[model samples]
Target: MELVVNSPLQNQIVGGEEIVSNTSRNFIEANTKQVTLEHLRKDCIIPVFAKDNESTISHYQFVQKTREIAQDLFPEFQVAEPDIRISHLIKGRIPSAIGKPAKELLEHEKTLYYERCAFVMEIPEVVENVNGNNLALTIGGVRAYNQENLFSKKSPEKFKVFIGFKNMVCTNLCISTDGLANQIKVTDVDQLSFAVEGLLQQYDREHHLGLMERMSRYLITEEQFAHFVGKLRMYQFMDKSEQKKLFPVSLNDGQINTVVKNYYSCPNFKRSDDGSINLWKLYNLFTEANKSSYIDNNFERSVNAYELTNNLVNSLQSGARNWFLHN
Candidate 1:
């Protein structure tokens, strides 16, 4: 199911104007690195199969224009390389000695231009969804930190856009740090956008909501409460002693007694002073143990119960904070 997205944002009027082109720039970056490693021995060769002068001129012009656009976008990266002589040849089928076909390459360049335009348009939305008003600050901080540390190797930056054709129904987004790639796959842009928006909203809601303080009142430490919550999640889904045996606590001198006392005091924990550990209690205990250590899953369920439990607690805490003031 799609998470959430701005429906009106899609199908908005887009100016049909050419913008910065990164096609050749991306292509060279992708190719050179691989070629340097000898992974791509000779420079990739693709044919230009145009029926007439107009068609052939159009294609060549597009390639040249795209190269110029790319240089403008990334002046540092686009430092002058020997101009690639695009061969003009006619054949029944296009020739591709190095990589994809000629037609494919042209289509790819067009895609790159459009993708950059789309990215510029959606920058606000992406920032709002990822880090809100603090997007620039976060990026700047990360960049500065990366720059300060000489030992830290930097990786090529990757950007992605989700495109949905035919309204919000069919959509996909392709992620590429592959500097060579001109065209990225967009399986369902609308759906992906919706999901991103939804996650952002969900995260926002959780952030506003504070912790389930009432439920956590009796817990000693955050870790203990986290464990308790983990067990609760496990018990809700897991079955019998088989699941029960999975979380054996490695007690130091009197850790079990300490856990028992903590659980007894907690409103959420379901254990009495009699030392009887209920299924709910067991779930939390097991979850905490697994999180503190490791437990192999029986494969009946997908996500780790402990991790989910912690996440749930965090969400709850965030929700609580949103609604109620914590002194």
Candidate 2:
């Protein structure tokens, strides 16, 4: 069985609202390139579907509708420009009997479209300072080519949306289960809007923030950190049945290596002189390491990091015999 986690701060009912988000950003290892909202509305081509298949929601449609919902939900808060990223450019030439050469017409006559996109918009006015790190209220949704099923009109399209605290110091999103809506399937703007509103209303901001505050209070010494790291490194090598008895692993080998490297050198989140790091710092380190993941996997990995770190904090406090955290 997995380690039993108990946190007083969770579900304590100290808040309101939910979060929706799309992708990760920190000027880190994302393959996505920044684009403006206008670009999607004006330049990007919505994918064409086969006769029996219905068209999925366009990138612009999902993002714009979410923006509208955020405004309606939080009318007093100022919403920032949609921070958009797009990738996998698909360009093709339409058949044309050009007077010019084919070589010259190839680049000029091609229609362009992106296969995947995601965006985040910050509500700067709704802010919180947890241990000197400024976290703004952030909402965003992700749309990728893999989520679309163009072969069947009967299949509903899936979209992932999230909202939570955006760590201002490092720009790593602090997401929890209460703030995310993954695989929320909808066919149109109205359905998507309803899903977003439901997600928003379900979030408990005060409780989520309180959990972070609690994490900031617990400290893990460097020795314990090394021990924990060793256990985590061994997790993948363990037999499947044995591994299944505990929590599923979150970081890959490279991400784990990155976490270890950043523990000693991360500018804002490294350990203290006494070789101790608070859980909140460890949480950031996890999110920071998560930057190496692909865009599609980013949202899930981010949530996993939060869950793993929260478990560790509980493990630290309860003196539980967690395989990863205890001897």
Return the top candidate by lDDT: 2
Report the error of model 1 at residue 249, Å.
15
Residue 134 displacement in candidate 1 (angstroms): 16
- Each model's lDDT comes to 0.25, 0.77
Off by over 4 Å in 1: 1-186, 202-208, 212-216, 220-327
TM-score for candidate 2, please give it.
Answer: 0.87
lDDT tens digits, residues 85-108, model 1?
111111222233235553444422
Q: What TM-score quantifies how close candidate 1 is to the native fold?
A: 0.19
Error of 1 at 63 (Å): 28
Report the lDDT of model 2 for residue 164.
Answer: 90
Residue runs of model 2 more than 4 Å from their true location after superposition: 1-28, 97-102, 106-108
